[model samples]
Target: MSTGHVEYASLNGTHIFKLIGEVRAHSCISLDKLLNKIEQQQNVVGAIVDLTQTTFIDSTVLGVLAKLGLKLKQVHHIQAVMLSTNPDITTLANSMGLGQVFVILNYCGDPSVCTLELTEEQHVTHSAMLNTVLDAHKTLMRLNENNQNMFEPLVKQLQKEQDCLNHDVQKQNA
Candidate 1:
């Protein structure tokens, strides 16, 4: 597998750190250095870890990312977003429960990407909405399991009622 190369650029006031090639043990040092620079930079409001070009990532590299995430959360309060197209890496992150800790996003297909300018308030609102949706989904799944029989019947009744209401409305219109 090819070794990793760390690239840095600034986009829309955010620091973009792109990890190209395979992220093995050696890449951690360079990644750490880039992260440190971003942390020290006052103008950087957010950081994106672009892993679109990464072919492989070892556990050691994951450990480094975990540590960096923790440090950023504690010190700078900077939200680190991971943009990866690699299925293996995405699965690994999901299985490890890293998604809850970081803003992990998948960018598939077209590689031409641009930074989105989001206000601080908008970012917070979006994060809150995401959390609310996840919580609601979990609650719905739990309710479905708890009242499977009741839910199925209730859903059927609602569908029947909706059909009747639609028929009545059509009749009235006609």
Candidate 2:
């Protein structure tokens, strides 16, 4: 599988993100930053995640997307839309209860409406990556019972890693 990259564009009040190749936790920091920027913007009307070209996406990216869906609903009172052309990706999203947070459609929306520019990839620290991963799984677990059961053990493991990282940081500072 090819390495993944994220592209983004803001058209009018709508924001669009395109994920290509295999998206993983390494890309979450950039994705998270974009989501934060959108959340802060006024006049934001809609959000769309285009996964037509996405071959593979890991749990961390999914969690960020889930978090985006929930935030859009909570802060802007608008439900986010996710476009997935691949059946496998669609099935994965559905299994993770993304349908509850996003309007999962099987077709690619109007691509000509906005030009998706590539987001600048940012390097991630181990501490940051672990934190993002842990928070993401926790968010996914909040979606439904199935997700909760599926992610609880992973969350527990991530929490342990986070604790260890924190301890090491403290010792270094001491």
Candidate 3:
């Protein structure tokens, strides 16, 4: 099944990113690309992550969003607001200590003015995906003590998977 997708629009200075359906590691490439595009914009002041229609969000995606928020704050001196009505998502963000990075909102004003720019999904190698997932989890781990405790096992698992994949690729090449 298709995991998830991201749509984004830049209006004025704030970039609006909408997460539709379930989001996983597969969506990170496009998301990262979009982030780059947003960075190139002339007058970017902030960003908003809309999760109103999202049904599921994996740890990797959450980590990516958290990192985005922190970068916007620390580097750009702007706030990244996450528009989410789902209690589960809100709770998860709080649990991961993302509240420090994101400003969660239940409603949005004039979203109609924003149109999403959707792109074809990017294909990533197994090792690449594994690395991305591992890095995302590491980012999450830096959020708080609880996040560190929660993602430590996942980080170790990803590391093991990456190691196995590397070995398999090496054997195939040999």
Candidate 4:
């Protein structure tokens, strides 16, 4: 698979996130942070995710993107649009119940705007990575019963690890 990088552009109040190449859990932290920032932006009226260039997207990236769609729908009352020409990726999105939160489209008209690239954070803590992974799976679970069944064991394991990590932190602090 091709190496993945994230590129994005904000046009007026509509924000477009373009995923190129292979997108995986490593890029999810930056993507999550960007999504949070956009959610807090008062001017955001729309959201779009372009996956035309995406060769692969793992479950973590899918969860993060799904969270973005859910947040846009809940906060801005706008259904996020997802542009995908690749059949495999499109099938994955549909199977994940992403269609409920995002309007899947085959076309994305060119937008005349400069794009910025998002890079992964240099140093990510184990706790933070664990939290991101756990949260991403939880978000996925919330999408449908199929997802819930698919991710329950992983979520349970992550939750246990999180509890232990919290206990360790408390002990060190004490």
- Residue 87 lDDT in model 4? 94
Could you tell me the lDDT of residue 106 within candidate 3? Answer: 81
Report the error of model 1 at residue 91, Å.
0.9
Preferred candidate (TM-score higher): 1 or 4: 4
What tens digits encode model 2's per-residue C-alpha lDDT throughout 1-120? Answer: 228888888878998888989988887887887788888888999988999989999998899999999999999999999999999999999888899989999886675655555654
Give the clash count for each candidate.
0, 0, 0, 0
lDDT by residue (tens digit), candidate 4, 15-69: 9899989988888888898999988988888988999888999888899999999
Q: In candidate 2, which residue ranges exceed 4 Å CA deviation? A: 111-122
Model 4: lowest-lDDT 10 consecutive positions: 108-117
- Model 4 regions more than 4 Å off: 108-113
- Candidate 1 CA-lDDT value: 0.57
Ranking of candidates on TM-score, top first: 4, 2, 3, 1
- How does each model score on lDDT? 0.57, 0.87, 0.80, 0.89
For model 3 the local lDDT of residue 17 reads: 84
Candidate 3 structure quality by residue, lDDT tens digits, 1-174: 456678878767878889888877788867866775666666778788888878888888888888788778777888888888889888877888788898888874465655665674556777667777787789899989888998899899888898888898899999
Off by over 4 Å in 3: 36-42, 108-111, 120-122, 163-174
Q: What residue pairs clash in candidate 3, if any at all?
A: none
